[model samples]
Target: MGNIALINRRNFLKGSAIIGSVVVAGGFWRAAENGVFSTGKGPAYTAWETSPNGLDGLVNAALLAANAHNAQPWLFKLGNSSIELKADTGRNLGPVDPYLREMYISLGCALENLIIAAKENGYSPIITYFPDQQDINYIAKIDLTTMKPLHMELYDAIPKRHMNRGPYDTTRDITQEIIVSLMNLNIDNSEVKLFMFDSQQDKLKIGQAMIEATQTLISDKEQIGVDPKWTRQSWQDIEKYKDGITTDAQGLPTLTRMIAKILPPLSPEQNNQFWLNTLKNKHVATAAAFGFVTVRDPQDYLQVVKAGQLWQRLHLWATTKGLGMQIMNQLSERRDREVSLNLTPVFGEKLREILGTSEWHSIIQFRMGYPTIEALPSPRRPVKDVLVSI
Candidate 1:
């Protein structure tokens, strides 16, 4: 194992630094600049601003979906009866996500949430992908004119869906029944497989492997810069960026933060020791880690986005069932995709052999269980910062 990249947790506890600042949003602000202000223009427009049943509600819900670095990268154009979903190019994590794959997946997650909310409110959304040539960033355009009321059980869990980073309760088991319900989302004939390691012994073993893998990946300078870009320095920084992950809200506990400063991404021996300590003392790997695998199509941005959408849906569904989840993508890195998904207990060597050069890159991974802790909500920038009026 290479040196373990320790997070500077003390920095968050010590308060603000020169470069980072915390700015939590307790009130509304101006709309995003270049805001989509439709006029008596090409497409007829009906403002959903006032109606309790229109665009306003959908926008609010869409805004809630998880994002990269909290960089909520999207803009909406309220048309006659539809909303346009455009990628906020300014928010791109160029260094890490240069291809913008993660951004699209994040957008897809948000889009799925919007659809769920819209349906519950009695409106049908018609989606058109890649609507315009000039705007390569524009992912989709949803025509809402034909929307109708539909019963969606997912609504009840919407409010509970949260990003959990705490230790999971390994004593409890996530049965095959729950796993089957999650697989139902893949009902479109997409080959989706669920691989889970639930026992405490299994979790510790997997966690050890994951920790080793993450340490190795982070030691690479190129990947380090990429990962840090997604990591917000402080909670205050988190609030201001309206995107990056925050320590106080999304990750480590106070005690862990103190150790972070001391470790500061140590040597290989230190990394091993850190992992040993984490396994011995901390509850970082609380639950059995879970992963999703797609068999038919392995490398399309659209498929990645679809997987993310299903991920968020399952995440919310788990939340509604009183469970929490934490994403673990270290093993899923493009470089180590083989080790992560290939070593599933059930498929064994056959799975590895079958993956064929299609490269089974992990789209998402999480640890789920009931959470008793209340995490501070990460802040979001005013919508105006990202919205571009077309």
Candidate 2:
């Protein structure tokens, strides 16, 4: 909160004017289809489509959630009247996420999806966190009992919801009604606190801070180097693994997505400028509004997971509202093995001053706006891949 300078309002307005013209002139641009999130049915639910009922389908629905670098670090153990979700420790991000905070939060996103899918498809889900204290890997067990299926828009939105990191319409403002709706979503999850910023000046501050965090991550060879592990380059690799971050998920234009396909995999060391420029556009410059999330304790495992469940609900609700959200979490990534990663301390202090609460630590940050196009959804691993036989 200290020594942060205000941005020039005139420049902000001018840039917004240009983006507004582009969006107004062209409307939501559609890219040539490569079979990701097509216009017809949207992203394929290979996992949920086959069964649509039973444990495998449930896990398949959960798999559709947003995750860390799209790692999808979770597994499902079939249960008679329940489905157990455990951390696939194999998917850990090491020092990049030293405490496995993102991993657990990712699991929470998945769990939220599973619960909604359960109810929509006629199963009543009762979730119990850390069902086995002896096993830290045991995130939660969702007890599924029979119920009369209740049709809901969120069930349809589960597949439709995705991170839109591309350029967005600047002239358009998020209605006060929408902002209030998003803020009120996590009322039941008392541990989660959200701070929303719709003002241009506030957005600039978050953008500047996020840019710093992004620079920090890419500057360190070890951190940026580790990122490639979860980044899929070749179409062959993305198709084979059916997981990890892909070029299409960046919300790039059709030309760029196609150009990316032609090139060989570039190392993060070589792409520092590309990463910086891309994120500046995606995270800072083009976004309409930004917000951050904080929980009671950053280190509490179950709290982190429940926070994620809350996030999933808000995300799906946003989807129903026709708003797109992208999580800018580099501010929360660890600088080393130490808790309260130094990279995020500035944001924490700033949040403390802004939110007027000293009890919460920042967990996730996001930008939401009206997009000019519908980017293809990221791919998911088949249900068989994550289902564990017990």
Candidate 3:
């Protein structure tokens, strides 16, 4: 293998180019002007800002769904008896998410959580996707005036679903029964397909490829810039820009998080060793299993959003089962349409073949198992923050 130092140096330029584009495009200025950097659920907290029975409350529950970078790239317009979900164009991630695939998936996640909450609170949500051809930002409208609340079991896990990034307890086996339950969650015959890798060999294959993907990611300066933008390095920054990733949310030990609070800000470029070693030491290699969500059409916007919805549902389901999941999908977000990862062409091909969908692209992947301890909750933007003036 090549030297880690050499690899880090090599990819720094590529990553820098992406960051430069974001700066040149004024992503930072726009984010700042729009107060996109702001974080924390202020005052009574967005979850309790409204009752669990109305559009506002439903939107609040949706706000808790996981999103790429925790950017929460969505806005809501409360209607007479429905809610409008729109993309927050102001919260850009530069070149890392060039086509905004992650953004739409994020909207879908919010949409899923909203539906679950709505159903539990006695309102039926009728979804209309891409309601307006002219306005691409108009994702969907949930009309809640027609039906009665049918409490779904997944509702309780809405707020509790989290992405745990720390090491998992390998001894705590995720039994076949639980795996079957998770697999059954693919009740919808959609274009998206979900697969779980439980075998030691499959896990090892993915674990190794993930290590390669991280090397590719760490070398790219643009991706580096993209990360620090959504990562709060200090306690002050965490409370201020309440939406980005923080140490506490990262599955770091309580003491480590405490130390992090007082230490000087850690730069994203200084991420070579940690990123490179994590896969082998903590993720796919040691987790209970690796899971993937693939789509027939990687370029299809609606399909991608639906993938996010499916992810949130499964993630919440995992939460209710007392399991934790960690997403490690750098391979899927590659610019190439094929499964070609940074490692070898054959590696991606193997993943596609194993999933039994040679033509489909893996949209997202994650590691799941029981956590050794409880995880810290990631902060979110208050409901009022995402409300668009209508």
lDDT, candidates in the order shown:
0.55, 0.71, 0.70
TM-score of 2: 0.84
Residue-wise C-alpha lDDT for candidate 3, range 1-390, written one tens digit per residue: 011110112223344454446557776664343223332234313453334445667888999888888788999998888899999987866655666777888898999998888888778789999899998899999888656768777888876777787788888877889888887887564688888888888878777777766666666676655776676654456556667766556565544443334334444555456556655676665688988887888778888889889899899898887889977766665443222333346446656766776766677888899897576567777777889965
* TM-score for all models, in order of appearance: 0.71, 0.84, 0.83
User: Candidate 3 — which residues are off by over 4 angstroms?
Assistant: 1-53, 335-354
> Model 2: per-residue lDDT, tens digit, 133-203?
89999998888889999788888888778877767888888888888888888765577777788898888
RMSD for each of the candidates: 9.7, 7.7, 9.2
Output the lDDT of residue 130, model 3.
88
Worst 10 residues of 1 by lDDT: 36-45
Better of 2 and 3 by TM-score: 2
Question: Which sequence of candidate numbers ranks them by TM-score, best first?
Answer: 2, 3, 1
Candidate 3 lDDT: 0.70
